[model samples]
Target: MAESKTNAMRLLDKSQIPYETLNYDHEDGQIHGTAVAEKIGRPQESVFKTLVAHQSGQISQICVFVIPVAEELDLKKAAKAAGAKKIEMLPVKDLLKWTGYIRGGCSPVGMKKLYPTFIDASAEGLKIIAVSAGRIGTQMELNPQQLAEQVKAVFFPLTKEA
Candidate 1:
């Protein structure tokens, strides 16, 4: 059964954005994007992982990226997309403070603050993609464009060439 509404889900509701919840099994420790995709029974490319990153010397400017679980974030490309000199993933310890989300369960929607967010351009043609529902054992599915709009995100080539 689907669990109760998460903060992310609640916000989606408030925005009147249509989405579907997907429940999956999760282990106690960190779960990789591929494992998440498998648990949710979706193609690896259709499942995205939310990453928190920031440009050097600009810790206050947090950037969010929603990219394929199977792909690696191309720091150089992502930095360019965000108009930064360089970009690096934020430390895991600081994730909650910056984004109000944890490592494995982070979602682009309903963050502590709306920072600059980007969805991998590859998500453009895909009909739907799955992301964390702001908690473990859960995911949400919807059109990538809709997700981007809800979070005021840009579509950019932020992932390494696959």
Candidate 2:
């Protein structure tokens, strides 16, 4: 059943990141990340969502953000970390093309390209965390360090009060 979803299972197999797959009835038109956390009975802080952003100016760069659902990404801090002046969230279509995942189900692993990946420093404190397995109604639990390693991510203080 888990293998039915291509994206998440692909990463699990490719990276050899041991994970437990969880499936729940995904409510139609539900608000995303938070709802998934609630369904799994985990604090929103322990569930991260992936976002894609594009930097402006001559050196345009595509970046991936992995942050807790309960926290807001500090654009300034992210820009500083990415060596950009400003960063803007990319359109959903662009996100799909770049990350190979949809808006509500993006995962840092198994992306179409290896962009600059940034994971909030808070994630480092957790022994295990959940992230989208590239689709709605599906999630995976894995060690934060292994997740970062698989994505080649840089840990930084990229989050702030929501």
Candidate 3:
């Protein structure tokens, strides 16, 4: 059976941005980023996760952040990067409503709208990084710069230290 193309994959193709699709088994129900990385045989640091947040007191002021799955987003830094005095993760129930993606399948590439996306600065040093392909069990790997360019995302120190 052939896998179908996701919105993220289609968008990447239309933009002529080179990317490679990596698929994994999701039936086990271990869809978290770290488990996904292990299933895909990639380092956790190379597999990033997409998170959606909104400026405090303003649901309309939404933004996206991409960070290594193993790391946590520094809310303060994320807020600063997004120019919000305070930032809060969008409620899990609202994720699909806001980004047209559900948990474990959200990709920064092709969201409902482009909303001030940012990638962790650490990704800038990596040759390649993987993000969800807008579908569960699938991922896309490409140069960090190319991804940033495609999504108009800036690189920033959005993650917290261990």
Candidate 4:
């Protein structure tokens, strides 16, 4: 293919943001976030997944939470970030309908609409991170701060306490 382009990548390019795309072999089965990191040969801490959350089960108030692959999103913190009293993971079945991307390929960069986005505060220290490239079998690596700036995301505690 002559350079796989995605809306996320296009937006990054338009803004002159630098990023590197990594392609992997995606299998049909349970979507494992950690596996994507392994497949891309990156540490789990530097790879995040774009997960969509709903406020009180309302899609109209849907928000995106980008967190490390190995952590579970703290719903309470997510609700706080989205300015909602409650939040829950958007059902896997509704991933495409709401985010315009499938379970394994949702990037925080380019959604159908720019919903409120949040990144785990832990990510601030990392110089760079890998996130879904808005397509299966692909990922993009870039600075977390750049991603945050592009998405206008809040950095906060987003993972459940162990």
Per-residue lDDT over 1-162 for candidate 1, one digit per residue giving the tens place of the 0 to 100 score: 656899999998998888999888776554788988888899998999999999987788899999999999999999998999999899999999998888888999999999999999999999999999999788999889889889999999988875
Better of 2 and 3 by TM-score: 3
Candidate 3 C-alpha lDDT tens digits along 1-162 = 877999999999999989999999999899999999999999998999999999998998999999999999999999989988999999999999999999999999889899999999999999999999998999999999999999999999999878
lDDT of 4 by residue, 1-162 (tens): 587699999999999999999988886553578988888899999999888988995767888999999999999989888889999889999888888898888999989889899999989999999999999888999999999999999899999998
Ranking by TM-score: 3, 1, 4, 2
Overall lDDT per candidate, in order of appearance: 0.91, 0.82, 0.94, 0.91
**What TM-score goes with each of the models?**
0.95, 0.90, 0.98, 0.95
**Candidate 2 wrong stretches, greater than 4 Å:** 1-5, 58-60
Name the 10 consecutive residues with the lowest summed lDDT in model 1.
Answer: 23-32
Roughly what TM-score does model 2 have, to 2 decimal places? 0.90
Model 4 residue runs over 4 Å out of place are: 28-30
Better of 1 and 2 by TM-score: 1
Question: What's model 2's overall lDDT?
Answer: 0.82
RMSD of each: 1.3, 1.9, 0.8, 1.3
TM-score of 1: 0.95
lDDT of 2 by residue, 1-162 (tens): 325855656766777778887776777666477888888888998999887888975324799899998778888988988998998888776776667778777878778888899999999999999988878777888999998888889889998655
Compute the lDDT of residue 16 as modeled in candidate 3: 93
